[model samples]
Target: MKIALIAHDKKKEELLDFVSKHKDVFSQHELFATGTTGLRVNERTELPIHRFKSGPLGGDQEIGARIANQELDAVFFFRDPLTAQPHEPDVSALIRLGDVYRIPMATNIGMAQILIHAIRRNEF
Candidate 1:
């Protein structure tokens, strides 16, 4: 399965920790992420990930395009809802596209854990 990993600035560390904890599970699949997030995950986990541009610079749109084309199987987006984002519209569009395509997505750590477990069990 192709899995996308994304995190807002404040949530990057949390996402990284989650990914690290699940590195064994994640290592079995293809991973994709936005620029800084991807770089950090790769550096910390040594997981090979395809990196897109920074979200404000079009990464969310890039991921959304994949969702539209049915290329991604799941998305793990650790969004920081309390903060204002400059690319809020793009983020909304990406989430909308995920729903439109019926792709499974997790916007928080709890949901992400469930999704990852589901993937492991071949529930999807």
Candidate 2:
């Protein structure tokens, strides 16, 4: 499965921790992420990840394209809803694409936990 790991600035640490916790499972799949988030996850977890541009610089759209192409199986996007993002429209478009494509997406820790387990169980 091809999994995308993305997070807003405020939620990067949380996503990193989640990745770390599930390194064994994640190691079995291909991983992709936005620039800074990818770098941080790779550095901390030693997981090989394909890195795209920063989100504000078009990373979300890049991932969305992959979704549209049926190249991505799941998305773990840890969004920071409380903060205002300069690339808000891009983010919305990405989420919209996910829904339109019927791609499973996790936008928070709770949803992520469920999705990760489902992946682990080979349920999707």
Candidate 3:
């Protein structure tokens, strides 16, 4: 399965920690992520991830395109709802595309845990 990992600035650490905790599970699949988030995760966990542009710089749209093409199996986006994003529309579009494609997505740690477990069980 192809999975994407994304997170807002304030939530990057949380996302990183979650990824670290699930590294064993995640290592079995192909990974993709936005620029800074990808860099940080790779730096810490040494996971080989395909990196896209920064979210504000078109990463979300790139991932959305993949969703439209049915290339991605799941998305783990740790959005910071309390903060204002400069490219809010792109984020919304990505979420909408995920829904349209019926892709599994987790915007928080709890949901992410479920998705990871599902993956572990070969449910996808």
Candidate 4:
């Protein structure tokens, strides 16, 4: 499976923690992430990751391309709804592409954990 991870500035630590706790499960698959989030996650776990540009700088589009190409299996996008983003369209497109591609996507922590757990349990 190929998993793409993205986190808003405020959720980076939480995302990193989640990845660290589930390193074993994540290690079995390929990982992709936006620049700073990937760097933060790498600091906490050994999961191999392909890093893209920062979300505001084209990372969302990079990941969106993979989703459109049917190259991604799942996505965890930890967006901060309370804060407005400069790249709203890119973010929206990524979310929309995930839906069009039928790939599982989690925009918050609860859903992210649920999806990861389901994948680990072979319930997908």
- Candidate closest to the true structure, highest lDDT: 2
Per-candidate local distance difference test: 0.96, 0.98, 0.96, 0.92
lDDT (tens digit, per residue) of candidate 4 on 1-124: 9999999999898888888888899999899999999988877786679999999999999999999999999999999999999999999999999988899999999999899999999998
Error of 1 at 22 (Å): 0.4
Candidate 1 per-residue lDDT, tens place, 5-118, comes to 999999999999999999998999999999999999999999999999999999999999999999999999999999999999999999999999999999999999999899
lDDT of 2: 0.98
Error of 3 at 18 (Å): 0.4
Clashes of 3: 0
Writing each residue's lDDT as its tens digit, candidate 3 over 41-95 gives 9999999999999999999999999999999999999999999999999999999
The window of 10 residues in a row where model 4 has the poorest summed lDDT is 39-48
List candidate 4 stretches off by more than 4 Å. Answer: none
Residue 45, candidate 3: C-alpha displacement in angstroms? 0.5
**List of clashing residue pairs for candidate 3:** none
For each candidate, give its TM-score against the true structure: 0.98, 0.99, 0.98, 0.97
> Which candidate should be chosen as best, given TM-score against the real structure?
2
What is the C-alpha lDDT profile of model 2 across 30-57, one tens digit per residue?
A: 9999999999999999999999999999
